[model samples]
Target: MIVRAVVEGRAVDADARFALEARYGHFTAMQVRDRRTRGLAHHLDRLAAANLEVFGAALDRAAVLGSIRAVLGDDLRDAGVRVYVVEHDGRPRVVATAAPPTEVSARPQRVTAVAYQRYLPHIKKAAGFAQAHIRRAAGPLGFDEALLTTGDGLISEGAITNVGCLSGGRLLWPDAPMLHGTAMRLLEDLDVPQERRPLRVADLPGFDLVFLCNSHGVVAVGEVDGVPLRQDAETLARLLAFYDALPWDPLD
Candidate 1:
């Protein structure tokens, strides 16, 4: 549940509601624990870069941080936070929202490949109808998530996660276009043998294990397109450990 919502360092008002309703902006979501978040700098940098692209202006990082801090305040230390830069009254505005914290799912997830791609896959848009639609449609099909792919069968990413295939003791990420999520960036910094290769739906059987990562948490994939994947608990645990070892940056 949402504990608080703020826009430009103040509670939601008419202008803030308009900005959110605009639906032509970008945002970043992260898990905040003890008033700190992991990969905070990367999250800020992502906002800046996306702001430049979406609004043709520089983002006020300090103001964005202020709104997030304002929403969290002293009473709320652990929560899920999202910082959005939206256009309102012909100017870009910052909106921050906080909710209960989230963690990686303990059970493995099942996903099916879908032949669909987003328009600007690099930037995480505020309202992605295609992704949301696919996610909702997945449940009725008896899948936990939808793995998006191109018409040519090239794997790109999940509806809300980045995918990695563990083959021969190495992690292989798809080379296709997709959002570079914060958790995936942190994972890339680890001292592991990982590479980017052109993966496809037909190549799922060759991998020994498959996992998904996002700002929320890391999770293992048990099946893809009805192809059963390896559920190597040791590998999944080791990957999560490497991610958790990263120091969390304070929200101050």
Candidate 2:
């Protein structure tokens, strides 16, 4: 099923454009089971924080969850749930949608680096034109995703998902401003050893095990800029098992 929003009163056309001065607002995606989601608090907090930054007001978590449940119902299991807190006519509004669950396999992917960085590093907003531009340009050449890097030759993250290098059982992240993924937060809370430091494009070929992670799960990188990576099957397995065991919280 696709994410169908339960639109109410006035019945504005779905194609209605954003108000003249409306800016890109916050959004979040989660996997729903039995009308519940994982990392629920973190997702909500993401919306709250972004709402404050973009709309200059606090997000109504309870009302937002209610809007989500209105669309999800009480028995939706294994669905792709999305929450959008957008600015309409200069005011913030909550909109939720749901679709059939889609999972990116743990299969290794081949990625290449691109020189770019996101506009809002801290807020998970609906601005992804740069990412889409890079992905479109790279996808045709048989690459899974584009790794965004800074002009100073520092690696940041991939087009959409976050990337990390595994070294001696510790996850090494780039020491730059970027979106802190909910998945990474969960992994850190799991006591997984991690460190943040500057990563250069020149070091991409030397990483023993580099993987991509987002809300779906973790997957290894088979190749980087035509260089084959040494896959770590054990680490991937452990991540999948641990992520699958995370508890789910109800929308209420």
Candidate 3:
């Protein structure tokens, strides 16, 4: 559920106008625990670039943090947080909201392929009707998520997360055009062996483990298109520790 929202340094009931009125802006979400998060500067850089493109002005990172810190008081430590900037009545406004934190599942996840790719594939824009539609469709079919594939049947990404496969303890990222997730970016700088290669559904069996990475953290994928991959504890633990090594940045 949405707690209160902040607009211009004041709290108010979270309104539908932010969704209905301005649907053409980019935003970033992260878990705020102990007033810190992973890749805080990266998130701010993303907002700076996307916000400039979407709202025609570069957003101040510290100012945005202030808004978030205000809505969430000194006591509220753990919560899912998002800072959205969009043009409302011809001016861009910053709105922040807090919600119950999303927990990463310890058990593996299952997803089925969907032949749809995200538009723009770069901006984390709020417009994702196609992705949401496919995700909703996947649930009734008994899957936890939807794996988005290119028209020619090459894997692109998951609807809400970036896809990665492991073979010989190395990561294989899909080479197709997709949003660069914050967690993935951090891992790229690490010492782990990694590669960028195009993946097809037929190639799933070539890997020992498949996992999803996003703001929530690393999660193991048990099955993809009825193909079962490793849901072993060791692989999950390694990925979690790899991600956790990225030092948190204080938002305050």
Candidate 4:
């Protein structure tokens, strides 16, 4: 069972965490093995590079919890699954079970195989080269992180989290080829300014601030190399407060 619990305010407990695997209704074990073998390494590499510490393979909460119940029966509480829960505004918001944080370099803009094809030989090869080039480009630029995308002007999300930018005091995200993440939808409902349009790299310099948002947490603008992002304390506080008040329902 995949347990979907609210992570209230960055609270993480190491003893209650567990991992999960999804059960597809019809696929045979052999089929599953075949699929898993195909792109497993690439997927794992991406997840690892993104600094995702805790991860589970459940499709949803019910599945996660059910698996726990099956394994431990009434003794589930003592299972030591290392669940990480965060709550905001007295409500649970994010949950995960995984390792502690990992370091992410700040430097050349993160590029992706999807985005680098125009400049590289093949998309598959481009994906492999993205990290190396980003590392090289960002080092001289004095930045610690670079984000990659599909180059179709679709800034979907970041290698690690969803992207949020401030343009004329309006919050915006790329419109196409990106997942409408739960947090992204919530922010939109709060009437935080949103722009569902193509996002260009050249446009980054025009934004007041740039941030990465996700179910796990939100990090404020610190530094994009030498670029000083506009940090509006009041705006951030209000936005966070708004998030804190939202229902845990991802669909809402």
Candidate 5:
């Protein structure tokens, strides 16, 4: 249950009216459920506690960033935990907690978790659930990475990174319910291509090329498995240029 809140004037608005967003990397989905049931503040406290144990300080950025992923796996249902990164000074800074979305319907969609082949068996089930989706989807397309979306209209990156694809030579991304990742922000100014419409899985094969993007950087799809992907070196270069322009302080 990672919570992000904005702090404006004298009011702490979790709605992000101010300029703050907090992400609490919980160890389990059960913990998220607990926080969802109890309250956002309680969830923040638990995440802060976990950060202190791993980093020994409340604002220890490295400890919080590095350990949150591992910690979330210990008790969470899936390897991945909810994360929230907010924009500040044209860059993203991690705040370790956030308020839940208000529009959560009574019947929320269930997030499925799957294991990957790159981690320890015990940890694989919990460590690579998100990544597994990437592998599974890419396996058939011969694509190493790709963007993920739900039937309802949520867009997120791949298991480990964000995704950007060229459609009709226009760059595009999903509108909401997707992680507002760092790399995605940096590319906002680029002229590669930008779209915010709902994209269907059936429409993937129509793309010219697909690439994965993240804080670690971007990687063009070499091979997904059996399917062959058209790789444009020029497009790949532009994507890398956007990646290199990121303000990677490592501390944030």
Candidate 6:
């Protein structure tokens, strides 16, 4: 369902595709509707910060936005977009790709905890083979996703989403070395009873609600490591409504 791809404000070429597929880089993804997206500022800031950390060079946020716009153009109003920053020919290059818009699934997800931590977990880098491998291995085992944890069994994050638990009417985000997702940050800005703390895999059964959030949307976790989780529909609906109600910044 890929719509189009652009690199450095131009159509992607063979060399660009090769560079993108093979090089190590970082990226930020979001759902764009009518040429607008929520948490646009957050995505831009993330690109800048990750650029600095991954490449040791300041990222040109304006250029990144331009690349995104280039791919979207005037007709492409709704799509799932990703902005990537990779080093090409001794410079950091921006790559933007667009695909059909995806909706947050209403069905609950069941995930299994794996003793795998992402290297430099804070930045959303392109080198994701390890986590992909773990996810592939877990898929045939009846798990929808892999919940990454530390060697000592502390929950860090999901393979592609941020994990949160509702306990005692308060939302708990694990304070571990993980990517602070755009959706998670936006949710934190809302008026919600939430806090950051260390979460352990053994404590999954004690929560009233468990959910996962990424740029696409938030979804409830039905099970973790074979432990059934309470799919609190009310809380999940409230969280999703709050996120959906956020203002969508114009891509222009």
Cα lDDT listed for each candidate? 0.87, 0.75, 0.80, 0.41, 0.42, 0.86
Better structure of 2 and 4 per TM-score: 2
Clashes of each: 0, 0, 0, 39, 25, 0
* Stretches of candidate 3 exceeding 4 Å from the true structure: 16-22
RMSD of 1: 1.7
Ranking by lDDT: 1, 6, 3, 2, 5, 4
Q: Give lDDT tens digits, candidate 4, residues 1-252.
A: 332222221333333322111111101000011111112222223323222222232223443333223433332232122222222344322233322222222222332212532232111111224546655766565554454556554455554345777766688777545433335555777675567777765566577666665444455545443545565677667666776675431100
Model 3 earns a TM-score of 0.93
Candidate 6 structure quality by residue, lDDT tens digits, 1-252: 557888898887656655684578899999999999999999989988988888899988889889989999888999999888887888778888888999888888889999988889999986688988998999999998888998888999999999999876798999899999998889887676788899998888788788889987888888887888887777777777887789999988
TM-score for all models, in order of appearance: 0.95, 0.89, 0.93, 0.47, 0.43, 0.95
> Model 2: per-residue lDDT, tens digit, 45-137?
888888888889988887877767776765666688767777665567676666798787766898988888888787777656667889999
Angstrom error at residue 151, model 4: 5.1
Which residue window of length 10 is worst by lDDT in model 2? 8-17
RMSD list, candidates in order: 1.7, 2.8, 1.8, 14.0, 16.3, 1.5
Better of 1 and 6 by lDDT: 1
Please write out the lDDT profile of model 5 over residues 1-252, one tens digit for every residue: 433322221223445532343222222111232222212232344445544543354633444344333333333322213333334465433433333322212221112222222322111121344565665766564344444455542444456555567756688775434444445556776765577766544444467766665433456554332344566777766666665554422111
**Model 5 alpha-carbon drift over 4 Å, by segment:** 1-156, 223-225, 250-252
- Under the 3 Å rule for N, CA and C atoms, how many clashes does model 2 have? 0
Q: What would the TM-score be for candidate 1 when compared with the true structure?
A: 0.95
Between candidates 5 and 6, the one scoring higher on TM-score is 6
